[model samples]
Target: MASKLSTTPGEILREGQLEKRSDSLLQLWKKKRGVLTDDRLRLFSRSSERAKELRFHSILKVDCVEHTRKHVYFTIVTIDYKEIDFRCTEESCWNAFITLALIEYQNRRALEGFRRHRLLPIAYEEQEESEEPRSPSP
Candidate 1:
C-alpha cells in the first residue's frame, strides 16, 4: 500500500520536522557543565589525580586518537575526569585535545591494572568475526 500525502500544515506537524540537526563545536562547548574552577586545592590533593607534575594549562591541548572495535561497535567518546583530573584558570585555552589524550591514557592504565589483577579474560567476545579474507569463488 502507498503512503498518504500531507493535506495540510497540521498533518505535517503531526510527525514533526524530518530534518536532523548537525552537531557543532559551539553546541559541545555550551553542553560542558561544572566549571573546573570550583575547588582548586581539594581537586589537586586527590590521590587519584594523575596530573601531579603536569601543569593544568599544559593539559588543555588535545591529542587525536582512533580505536578499532573487535566487533561491530560504536565507541563512546566522552571526556570524564575520574582518575586524571586537571583544572586550569585559563578558560581561553580550554584545549579539548589534551582532555581526550588524558582520558585515553587513564583508560590504558585502568586496562593494565585489570590485567595485573587477573580481572581481564583471555577470550572475551563470544561472536568473534572472521579475520581471514574470503576469496571470491568463480
Candidate 2:
C-alpha cells in the first residue's frame, strides 16, 4: 500500500464496504461504505448518509483482532482509548489500508516536527548573534 500512498492530504486511498459493530446494546453489525482518505476513514450508511468518522489524528492504532474463513476483524483504538470494532472481507484488506494510511500520516507529522525543531535552533542562534555587539568590524 505504501507504493500507492498519496502525498496529497484528503485524497481517497481506498473505498469499500465494511461491517462495523454498532454501539447499541444489541451490538449489531452494520454494513457501511468505508472511504479511506489520507487523513481519516469516513463511514457512510447504505443510503449515503454520513455515519461515523475515524480521523487519523485521533486514532492511536488499528489492531487485527480476529480472522475467520470469510472475514477479518479489526479494532481501531482512539487516543482516548476507545475501541471501535470492524470487519471486512479478507481480500478487501480494509484494515491494512487504514493502518498504512494512519502510519503514513503520523510519519509525515513527525518529519515536519523534526524539520521545525532542526531549523529553530539555527534561527535562534542567528538572532542571538545578530543581537550581540560586533567586535569593531574586524
Candidate 3:
C-alpha cells in the first residue's frame, strides 16, 4: 500500500507520492501515496489502513498557490469551502494532472445533465403527439 498505489475499481489516471499538509496544529507535511481516478482522488498513508477519498463531485476546484524551483504547492477547494493543501516536486506536475482530471470530470457531468434534461422533453412531446386523436387523414 505504501509503495504501490491502488488502481482497482476505477481507471488510473495518475499515481504518485505527494506531501499533504496535516490539519493539526503543527501542520506537518506527511508523505502520501495518491491515486487519481475518473471519479475521485485517493490518498493512502502508511500509518492509516483506510484511504482518504476526495471525490470529484465534492471538489470545487484545484488552485495552484505557488511554484518554486523544488516544489509546486496547490490547494484543493471542496464545495463546502474546505481547503486541503498539497505539494509535489516541480517536475512531477501533479497540480496540472489533478486540475485537468477535475475539469474533464465536471464537463462529463454537465453533458450528462444536459442530455437527461434535453431527452425528457423530446420524449414527452413524442408521447403527447402519439396520444392525440388523429382525425380523418385527408
Candidate 4:
C-alpha cells in the first residue's frame, strides 16, 4: 500500500503520530505515523500491510473527543460507523487542520454545484438567442 500512497496527488496538510484505540476496557492506544492530504488521510505503520486510508468523503463527522495539557484527541467517524482516534500535541494541532480542510473541501463542492446550476440556465438562454432569426435593419 505504500507504493499506492504515492499515486494520490495532493498537498500535505499535516503529518504526525495518530493513536488508534484498540480496546475499550484497557483503553489501549496504538500509535501510527500518518499524513493527511486534501482528499484523504493515510496512516502507515511499521509494515506496509497496516497502511490505512480514510477518504474525506467517507468521513461522516470529526469531533474533538478529548483535550489535555499534552495532547488533543480527535475522533473521526466514518460513514460505516468506524471511529478512528488521532492524537496531536498542542504544538502540532492536527485536529484543527483536518477539520478546516474538510470544511474547505465541502465549500469547494458547494461552489462547483452552484456554478453548474447557473451555467445551465445561461447556456440555454444563449442557445435560444442563437437559434432565433434576427430582423434586418432598415
Candidate 5:
C-alpha cells in the first residue's frame, strides 16, 4: 500500500503479474537476488485484478500457442508488437485475458470478434460477395 523509495507503480507492476498493479512485484524482483518463485506469482494473481478491463484489450493481443505436446496449449500475448509478453500458463487465452483484466480493471468488455473468430476489429480486406452475411429465408 505504501510507495517504495525508488519505485513507481508501473515499475513495481512489471514483475508482480500481468495485471495492472504489477509494478510493485517487478520492483521487488529487481531489488531481490533470489530466483523468481511461483509463490510470488500466486500472490500477485490473487492480489490484483487488472487484467479484466476492456481499455487494456486493444493494447493487448491475447492468443494461445500449441505446445510440443498435443492438446496442450498456453497463452501467448503480445502487446503493440512489443517483444515483451504476458505468460498465462494457468489457463487458455480467453481465461488468461479475463483473469488478467479482472485483476487490472474492474470494468471490462472483451470484443465478440476476439472470442468468436480471433478477428481484428478494424476491417482490412473486403470479403467476396459470396462470403458476405446472408439473411434467413422469409
Candidate 6:
C-alpha cells in the first residue's frame, strides 16, 4: 500500500473509521480510517493507503439517510453525481462537520472572488466616467 500526502494544506478535523456500504451488497460494508481536513475528506484502507478523497468544492450537499439510537448514516454527493456513504457514531456528528467545512470553503471562495473583482478595472465604465458631458445645441 502506498501512502500519499494531502493536496490541501489545512488542519485535520477528524480521523477515524467510517463504514462505507458496498455498491452490490447493501448488507456488506467496509471500514475506512482517514483524516478529514478543512478542505477535503480522505479515506485510508487497511494497508494505510489513501483510498478516496472528497473535496469540499466537489460536494454539492450532505444528506442524512437514517439516524438510529447508536449510529447515523449519511451520504455525501458530489457535483459529478458521485455518492459516498458513511456510518458513524451519533456523537461524532460527521454530517455537521462536513457541512461546516463546506460553508467555510464557500465563504472563502466568495471572498476571494470579490477581491479579484476589485483588483480588475472596468475599462468601459472608466471611459464613460472620464468623458465630460457636452452642452445641448440650440
Best candidate (score: lDDT)? 2
Candidate 4: segments with Cα more than 4 A from true spot: 1-9, 23-27, 133-138
How does candidate 1 fare on TM-score?
Answer: 0.22
| lDDT (Cα, tens digit) per residue for candidate 1, span 47-116 | 3433223333233333223223321111122234323322222322232423433444455556778886
Model 3 lDDT tens row, 1-138: 122233354888889899999999999999999999877999999898689999999999999999999999999999999999999999888898888878877887898999999999999999999999999877
For model 6, residues 1-138, the per-residue Cα lDDT tens digits are 112233356777778877777787555778878678878888887876756888888988889899999999999899998888888889877777777777777777888898778755676578777896977999
lDDT of 2 by residue, 1-138 (tens): 765544676778899899999999999999999989888999999976856788899999999999999999999999999999999999999999998888888998898899899999999999999999878855
Off by over 4 Å in 6: 1-8, 122-138
Per-prediction TM-score = 0.22, 0.90, 0.89, 0.77, 0.23, 0.74
Look at candidate 2 and give me any clashing residue pairs: none
The better candidate by lDDT, 2 or 5, is 2
Which stretches in model 3 have alpha-carbon errors above 4 Å? 1-9, 136-138
The weakest ten consecutive residues by lDDT in model 5 span 31-40
For model 4, the local distance difference test gives 0.78
User: How close is each model in CA RMSD to the real structure?
Assistant: 22.4, 1.7, 5.2, 5.9, 16.0, 7.5
8-75 per-residue lDDT for model 4 (tens digits):
45878678776777657887777778888878888887566476888888887789988899988889
lDDT of 3: 0.90
C-alpha lDDT score of every prediction, in listed order: 0.30, 0.90, 0.90, 0.78, 0.33, 0.77
Best by TM-score: 2
Clashes by residue pair, model 1: 61-98, 62-97, 62-98
